[model samples]
Structures are given as structure tokens and as C-alpha cells.
Target chain A: MVTNEQRLACAYLLKVGEPPAPALRSFVSEHGVVAAAEAVRSGEVPDSVATETSARRHIDTAAEDLAAAKSVGARLVTPEDEDWPAWPLLPLTNAAARGLKWASPPLGLWVRGSASLEESLQRAVSVVGARAATSYGEHVAAEMGYGLASRGMTVVSGAAYGIDGAAHKGALNANGRTAAVLACGIDRAYPAGHSTLIDRIAAQGLVLTEYPPGTPPARHRFLVRNRIIAALGAGTVVVEAGQRSGARNTAASAAALGRVLMVVPGPVTSAMSMGCHDLLREGLATSVSSVAEIIESVGLFGEDLVTKPDSAARPTDGLDSEALRVHEALEPRVAHAAERIAEASGVPLSRVRALLPALELTGLAERCESGWRRAKEPV
Target chain B: MVTNEQRLACAYLLKVGEPPAPALRSFVSEHGVVAAAEAVRSGEVPDSVATETSARRHIDTAAEDLAAAKSVGARLVTPEDEDWPAWPLLPLTNAAARGLKWASPPLGLWVRGSASLEESLQRAVSVVGARAATSYGEHVAAEMGYGLASRGMTVVSGAAYGIDGAAHKGALNANGRTAAVLACGIDRAYPAGHSTLIDRIAAQGLVLTEYPPGTPPARHRFLVRNRIIAALGAGTVVVEAGQRSGARNTAASAAALGRVLMVVPGPVTSAMSMGCHDLLREGLATSVSSVAEIIESVGLFGEDLVTKPDSAARPTDGLDSEALRVHEALEPRVAHAAERIAEASGVPLSRVRALLPALELTGLAERCESGWRRAKEPV
Candidate 1:
């Protein structure tokens, strides 16, 4: 657990370090916060990556930063805090975290809101998309947010223009909780038109940020902040993202972490729905279009009920004759390697290697160390 | 094999009998066409429901219909012919055909086109939907038809107004092969405005129908004709069906027959797209938009590649703690009835019956005479 001083010091480091400085941020995690802070204070390079001069700029200003944060009614949450969203915050884990990507999970979060952070995010779903979403996309996002929020699942977003703005407003209008995980400092956030939206969000649910007071928004910050929006929610839904929208980053994070990733399909001709099509086509996400569908993807009720069978979800149902022939070769008890499984299955070896993972992902084949065991589920 | 006399007789029967007359058709298949024609002539009810006098209506006018069909450059194909679309016409099997509901496989098909009935339909895809389709729906259907046609797959439709017209027109415009599976007889099919369009389809590809040369189009005939559209294609894609459109029957036939079924989703606000959404929600079809996606659902390429996995397809991936507990209680080897499985699974009987099919469809379990057995596909 981090001490109050160490927590405050970590807050100071957040202000000085470049946003999404994975290397330095990782160093703090690797070397204890105090030791890492001491290195920065003593003007010693914390690692080969940090220069002595740059390290000095990271000196502790915890006292000042903490006071500034409190002055605005913000509360600091560290990894050790009870309010921290642990499960969805998986990008912080060593193996899951991506390298120098535009998006990364935050070291600590600053929040201000009436709702309890713990409860607000426990069943949260991130509804995000292009800032310039069309009216159709906005309507979908709003409906999704309202529907999900009304079901008691908080809606999380960047609180940007278009889909995000609509989603936040929907949740607020429904008298349901929502959270805005910002790209800038909670105090320094801008695009002034969203001030009312953000303020309502802070009052109704939460306004969260990784940056300390006075940090300016940058191109990379929003990209980096996308990970937080993804990590804070139980699932991430792209309502109407463009092909290159930052919401795609959140989608990637959600997929990598095995979150329920869904995309609301729109008109195939719309530029706004392109990312959604790409995601659906690539099998990165499944298409969902309503609040009930959104719940089916991320809520607890999904687990308790045995829903109707989805043939699309079972790609195994579509296997070619050869692949299906190969799949039938392995025994449930035997852990057959690729060559043996191929021989047993009467399919060529190259095809088995490729077919096994498809089977594995479809929950058909198990990838033991020996490899290629038929999944014991009934065929 | 259908002798020339028997063929002509069947044509006469098609003109008089209610289309899809599954009972009378099955009688012919069972008793042989000559005997069935003899029975119709003797005015002796061939089966229970065939009243003596009403049965006499099913006489052989094969000679007359054949001459009329030839006059319009049409060729009649029967189940006995090599040109027949056989495999997808599963309703011909004794136990498989459902009682008259919407549509069923045809007793015979009339064809008029340059393309071979066998080859053109080998990779055909039915693109169908609402007659009152929106511009968006029509545009999508057209593009999908054109793209699929360009990829060398035959585009099949009823050639109605809106989506179906657009789909056929798109395929015709691309100079690609297309088939119009009409509800009426080939020579009497067109709805005035679509006459030239129908002519072009007949010239370029095929204008086919189960109705004999002079039968008029009727509501029930269209409903029955939808089964042929479903049966004749490798897959069916509903572009913009209304909630009660005949396209829904094709979708249902496609699903029940275990054919690849896809629906192109449009704006949720569009009532035409509602049927698509309902189909998708009910797991009756996967949502698709483009030719590539359409092909992905129907073509063999999907099985060879390790496409990224779809999370929605794996609803079991999100089992709640209680659900997980219930699932884990069942033994892998046991084939337990619903009540027994419930006892073993520690789930309530009602939930067990509900969950079992979902599990069975997911390939996690198998439904047997005794009850549910653990699926052997593998854990």
C-alpha cells in the first residue's frame, strides 16, 4: 500500500512526467514510488531513458499539487484504494500493458462526483465514439447510454463532442450515474462548450483524470485516456466511431483484456460506422444495436440466463469440410501435438496449426503444452 | 425420373393445385407420377384429404403447358432433372417438411435464362427485402447485389419494388448474372414496370418460378415462393425487410434448414430494418452489410483463416458466479434428463431446460433422448 506521502508524491510525478510516459511510469511501478521519486529528486537518471536534467523536473511537488486538487473538491484514488476499479484496470498489469502506445492505463486517478466511484463503475459500460458523430450515431449512443444507465449500469466516456457528449447527456437525463474520464486535468479541461456537460457529470457521477491540476489537453492525452475509459468499464461499446477514431483504441484495450466488446452497427455507407464494420468484419467485436443488447453483453443478468443459441457466435458451425474433418480427429482425452493431430485428423500439418486456435477461441480445442486436444464439449 | 408425359402432367397439377401443395406433391413422389395422375383421373382420392371430385382437378395438362412454356423460350425443370437444385430442397424428405405455414420447396421450376440453372445457382445468394424500402435500404441492397454479382455469385430476388428491385437492377446494371425467382409463372410474372427488368434478368441469367407457365401471382404464392428463394440459394440475406414481409419467411426457412442466413442492418429508426434487427436479436441470422461479409458467412474462406474471434458469440464467457456454479456441477459423462440434470447441475429445472439448449447450441452440451449430456467437443 502506498503511504499518504507516497500517494501525494505519485500525484506530483504525474504532473511532471509526460502523459502516458509508459517507461517512466513503469519505472515508478517497478522501483517503489518513494525510491523512484528519490531518484528524480537527487537528479540521478532513474533509468537509461531518463536524463539527469529531465529527472530533476520530476521532483516532488506533492504538497502543492494535493492542496490544489483539494481546493477543487477532488479526491485522489491510488491503486491501493478501495474505490479503485481493479478488475477492468488490467492494462496496468505487466503482461497486458501495451508499449508506447497512444493509450495506457493511468497510475492514479483524480475524481470528483456525488456518486460513489466504487459502485458507479462496478457495472459500468463505456459508450464512446467519434466527436463528429452523425445524428444517427448520436441517437444510438444516447439511447444506449440511457438504457444502460437506467438499468443501473453507469455509463463511462471521455465526455467529448458527438457520441460521447450524447451518451453522457443521456445518462444524466435519465437520472442515472455516468463518469467522464478526461484527457486533461480535472481543473484544466476545455473545449469550453462541454463545461456544462462535464459539470453535470461531476455532480451526477464522476469527473476523473490521471493528470494533476493544470495539465493541458494534448492529442496524445485523449488517446492515452481512452484506455482509462475502457479499463473503468465492464465493457466498451463504440456507438459510431470513424475508421481512425480514438474509440478504436479503447476497443483494442477491451478486446485484449477479454472484456465484452460490442459495436453498434450503423448504415454501411456512413463514414461514422466504418470502424464498426471493420471491427465486426475482423471479428474484433460483435454488432449490437440496442440497450437490451448492451446489457446482454455486459450485465450480470447475462450470466444467469441461458439465452437463445447464436449460430454466429459458434464459428465452428461454418468450418470447411477439411477443417471440420481435421477437428474430428483429436480425442477429448488425448493432448495431441500438431503433427499427430493432423495425422489422426487426416488434414495436413499447416492447416492444423491454423485450425486449432480458431477451434480454441471457439471453445472447441484446448491448447495444452502437448497441444491440439479436442475440446470436451459435446459436438 | 420424370417421363415427358409425367412432366406435362405435373405442370398441369402445378397450375391447378395450390402451390407448395406439399401433400399432393408428396403423394406424387410416393406413388409415382403415372399412378398419381391415374388416381387424379379416376377421381378416387389418392390420400385422406383428397376429396374424390377435388382430386380430379390435378389432371395432366402437361402437353398444353409445355407448348406454352416453349413459346416463351422457357424450359421446365423437375426434381428428376440434373439441373435441379437438390440438396437445399430438404423438405422433399418424408419427416422434414413442415405442415403448410409459409413456403416449401417446389414440385417443379420453370426457367428462362442464358446461364445454366445448375452453375448459376451453385454459388447464388438471395438478396431480398421490403417493397417499400427506403433510399438507404435500396442503395445497400443494390450495392450488395452488384458486389456479390461482380464476385461471380448469382444474385437472386423476387424483383419486387424497393430493395428487391434495387438488388436485381444493381446486378443487371453490373452486367453480372442474376435470377428472378418469381411468384407467378415465368411468362406471366412481371408487374408492368418490372417487365423489361425481368426480361433482362431472364436474358442475362434466369427467371425461374415454381408456378407453371400461366399461374397468376398471389399473396400465398409469394409466401410459398419464398421457400424456393431460400432453397435455391447458397445463403439468404435480408436487406430491409419489414416486420411482416415475405423476406422473413425466407430467413426462417434458411435458419430451420441450417443454411447460412445473414441480414444487413440499417438505421434502427427505419422500420424496414426492424425485421433485420429482430432476426439478429433472435440468433436467427448474423448481421452483415457488404458483399465481403455476405460471402464470409456463406463462402469457405472463413474456415481456412484464423479470423479474429467474436466475443458476442461466446456468451458463456461471462457466466455469473452462480451460473458458473450450476454449470460446473454437471458431470461430463452423464446424460441426464432436465430434472436429473438440474439436480446434478444444482440449477432449478426450469432454468436447466432453458440453459441446456443455449449450451447445446454453443457446443457445450448435447441434447439426447434421456436429457442433456456434456458436449464432447472438449473443455
Candidate 2:
């Protein structure tokens, strides 16, 4: 349970403090919120600490803002909250990913809507791409989103226009659970045109953010928020990204975190799909075109899905050099007796006869009344 | 050495013989075509050999066909000719490729065009694909073909419709050297519709086929001819192929022959590109979108070509755990003193200060009046 002091201190920190700061979190973690607050009030805090005039003045308002959150029917989920996600473990992964510089698990998240953040993220899949997506990209993204949602997986996205909007709509159209992780406050919609859609999402799904209420969306905030979406999902799918998409950052973070990274293939000609094609070519992500495929990739020991068969069935690859030499020696469209074949191939007659039937079995040779003719192609 | 007996004997063998046959070739090779024909006429040939009446009845016609070929301005290049393509050495690569059974070096080629068979193929790329290719596939094929030819590289292809025709036209449009390896006689146009195109290829480039003149195109002939396309070029690029395209056969042959195999990616939505996509996903072919990229892949000491710059320039990949944690601890858009970051991140103040400057050098963190904040995604 959060104490009155802990509540007030958290509220104060949330109101005026810049986040992810080591000093403030350490001070709060080491000492109870009450002690930290008292230290700030007495101007006796560590020299590294910044108890700015605005944060001091906002002390009284922290209580009121906490009440406002309740009034709005939203909950502030802290690290101590039972419902907190496991993404706080990212620091360990990011140590290897080197993504820690710009990517961090949120200190806390303010979530709204009836769905539980815990439940929503348990089996989540993120679908992200360019804001300027092509119809081909959008269509593929929507199908993937809908398919993933219909399979009982929560779909997560940033809720921007183009691919993001299409993904959200596809998930919603399937009447499936979805989550929108925003850079701005959960109380506001950054893309004004998406206000209604955001409301719909909040009504049926969940709206989550690390920013406090009234925080406006900023460029860096969005970059920071992308990690949240990636970390919350079981895997991240890049439906379509341009050469310089912010979605690429999300992919990197997921990859760094050892999260399953998948990509949808699009026309190589479309600029929107260039990032996807490049990722696939560079071997950074596996290619998946359908929900089943995506699930197969992220699913635990997913062996139910079948792989595409190799188009190559040439048994010609099985022939020994001597047999191949004899096979190659036999004429196309012309039959050759064993003696003739042996003479032409420089292999002995016994060896030529020994090789002919085996080559015939591999479909590289055919028997005719005159002798044996080479198949149109070797095995 | 145009011996009359050798000419008549070669004509007879060419007229009725199945190719790549060891015994007949050995008979011709060991004692010359004259001896082989004389043995056939005298019933002294190997027991496995067939001395049928029909071939003997056509004996008089053999000399006539040879005379006719000369009259029409064509040369029949035999294995004995110094101008045979290096493909005769395919057995060496095929030994490694395990392609001996279905693959063979051609016996001889009837050349109808003036271009040197050996020189034309020294530096060549084969662009071949489905006969029923989509407009997009054809478009890409044409561009690749034109680009390759414009770069002074010869383009080789089977002279079929769709991609093949487009490839030929693309080369011709650029007034570049091109070669068409046909299934039928060089004098016979199979598609009939491509008679003019075939003529243009023969006129501006070369028309070569392994089949003797007067032979007609057959289903198996096309299949057998595909290998020549693969062997004639330094590499083979599949512009588009359906799941069951014969182009896949050529790609397999190319792989078997150790030729560089490449594919031009198309929209995954199109079935015509499925084979190409599958090959790419299966790691069977490298993807190339333009002539420059194709050349880069096949060029000697190709690694000298510059690599594409990584979009993620964040030197975060270089930071250690302690530095990464401190870097991650610093808030985005907000700076903090070293002491503050140390406290929050659980590192000592001195260590935090030490890590900060290095992180700053890596462009993962930056110093500000407030202290330090993350650098906006490094260079």
C-alpha cells in the first residue's frame, strides 16, 4: 500500500520531475517517500538532487492531481503494483543491446480503460510501420493485425495514421483486445483527428503512457514511447517501414531485448517496404506473411506450423562424379548403347552400364530400344 | 581439316544420334567420325550400339543437311572446336554441386549469328523468368536486362515470351549484345510470334542452340535448353517465377553449376513472384534490384564495393553495462547532475562522472547546463 507520504512524493515527482533520473529514483527508493519529501522541504537533500521551486510549489497540487486521476477512472501503476509488466527487466537485455542509452522501461504507467495492462500485455504482438504507408502495406498490416487479434493476442501500436491506424482498426474490427501506447498523456490524443478512435480504444481496450496527465507529445517522447510498445509485446512485427522510419527503432529495441522480430514482405518497388526488404536481406528479421506464421515464430516451441516446401526436387544433385560424367556423356534426345556411352565418356563399359540404371532411376537417363538417352534434364 | 569422310560421318551422327552419349562419342573420339560411321555401316559396332535401317536410309541426307547449313551461313561448333564455352568445365563445378546426373556439357552448337560464342559469354548475365509474367515482373526484367547490357555485360536468356522476350527487347533497346539459347533449330522460331524478335537477336546479337538445325521445339527441349542458359552466363537472375515455374529449374541448374544465383524481388501479393520470394527466403538466391547491385554481387573482389551506411548510428552499441545504465538513467529531454544520475542508477558519483564523458563521446549521452541528457540518436 502506498502511504500518504509515498503518494504525495510520487505525485510531486510525477508533476515536476524529469524521469529516468538516477538521483531522484535512488533517493525515493532508499528513503521512504515521506522522508524524501521532508528532505526536499527542509532543503537538506543530497547536492545531486534538484528540488526546483515549481516542484516545491506543486507539492500541494500533487494531492489534487491524484484525486483527478481517480475521478477520471484511471489507475497509476507503479513498480510495486502487482499489475506492473515485466519490462523493467530490460536493463539486463539492453546492456547487451546497447539500446539502454535511449530505451528504458517506464518508471510507472498511467493506464485507462477496463482491460488490465497485465492481461493485455501477457500475449501481445506489436504491428508498426510508416505513417505514410502504401495501400499494399496497409492492407498487409491490417490483415496481420486482424489475424493476430483474432487468434487471441492483444495488438499493440502507437496509433498514428497509415499502418498504425490501419492496424488498430483491423484489431478493433475483429473485436479483439488492443493497446495504444502513447507518447503524450493518456488523457489526451496527440493526433487530434484520432480523438474518437482513441476514445473507442480506451472504451474497449486500453490507453497507456508514462507521461503524466497534460503532457504534450514531443519528438523525443515518441522515440522514448516506442520502446514501451516494443517491450510490452511478446514480439514486434514491422509491416512496412520506409528507409528512415521511427518503427525501425522499435525493431532494434525488440531485437536487443531478444524479442522475436518478424517482418512482412512487400513489393520491393514500394519505398514504404524498403526497410522491410532490407531487414530481411540483412538477416535481421524473419519473414512472415500471415497471422499463423507470426504466431509460429513467437509461439513457444511452435512446431504446428509447416514450412514452405523447397521448389528444388532435382535428384541430379545426388549423382556421383563418375555417374554424372556418364550421364552427361549420353546425348539429349539421342539414345546411346553402353559401349558408345563408355567410349564417349571415357568410362569403362562395365562402369557405364553400372551408372546408367542408377542415373535412370534419378530421372537423368531414359532407356529406349536403341540404348539409353539422357533425360531432358538431370535429376 | 575438312575430311569428306569425317564431314559425312559427323552429319550422319548429328542427324540420328542422341547427345551426351559415351559409346557413340567414344567411337567418334577414338577413331574419328569416319570410323564410327564405317563401323555402323559394317555392323562392327559395339553390341550395345544400334545399327538401325532408318538412320542408314537417312545417310544420303546427312551430307545434304551439312551442305545446307553452310549454304545458310552458319557454323556447327563441335567439342573439338577451340571456341567451346568454358561450360565444358561445368563438370568440375558440378562435381561440387552434385549436378552430374541431369546436367551435361553440350556436344555441339549450331550458331546462326556472327557473334563469337566464346567471347559473347565471357561476361554475361542471364535474366529469365515465367512465360506468363505480370507487367511488374516484365518491367523489372526489362530494366535489369537493359541496365546489364548498358554496362557492357551481355544478357543471355531463353527466347520465350514475357520475361525472356522483355529481357531480349531490353537489351536490344539499349543496342547491347544479347544471346538467345533456343530449344529448337536456330533456323526455326518456336513461339512463331517471336520470329521477328528472334531475327533481331540473331541480327544484333547471337542465336545459338545445341539442337541440330531443322529440329523443332519440344516440351523437353525447352527443359534441356534451360541448362544452356544457366551455363552460358556468369550468373542467372530470376525476375519472376510462379511456384512451379521452369525458371526454378534454371535456378537450380545455376546453383548446381555454381553460377551466382540472384532474384529480383516483387510484391509478395503477386503469385508470379512467389518462386523468387521463396528462393530468397530459403536463402537460395541473393536479391538485386538494379544493374549496379547485380554487378556488385558478381564482381571480382566485390567486397571492395562500399557497404550501405547503417541507419542506426547510435554508438550505444559500444557502451559497457555501467555506462549503459548511466546513459539509460539520464532522462530524455531533461538533464541531471552527475551525482543525481549516480544515485538513481546505483553507480558511485565518481564512476557516474567517469562514464558520462565516455558515453558523451560515443554520442549516447551529452553534457548540458543541467548536467547530462541522452544525445538524439547518434550519427
C-alpha displacement of A333 in model 2, angstroms? 21
RMSD of 1: 24.4
Chain A TM-scores, candidates in order: 0.74, 0.75
Q: How far in Å is the alpha carbon of B275 misplaced in model 2? A: 1.6
Worst 10 residues of 2 chain A by lDDT: A51-60
lDDT of 2 by residue, A150-195 (tens): 8888889998988888888889989998889888777778799998
Query: Clashes in candidate 1: how many?
Result: 14
lDDT of 2 by residue, B55-164 (tens): 23223456666666676666777655567675534543354335363464554677877888787777889999999999998888888889888888889998899999
Query: Deviation in angstroms for A106 in model 2?
Result: 2.2
Q: How accurate is candidate 2 locally (lDDT)?
A: 0.73
Residue-by-residue lDDT tens digits, candidate 1, A44-158: 7544325212522534567777888888878788766777776667654633364534344566888888577777777888999998899999988888888888888889999
Candidate 2 clash figure, as a count = 25
Real contacts recovered, all predictions: 0.14, 0.15
Error of 1 at B363 (Å): 54
Error of 2 at B218 (Å): 2.9
Q: How much TM-score does chain B earn in each model? A: 0.75, 0.78
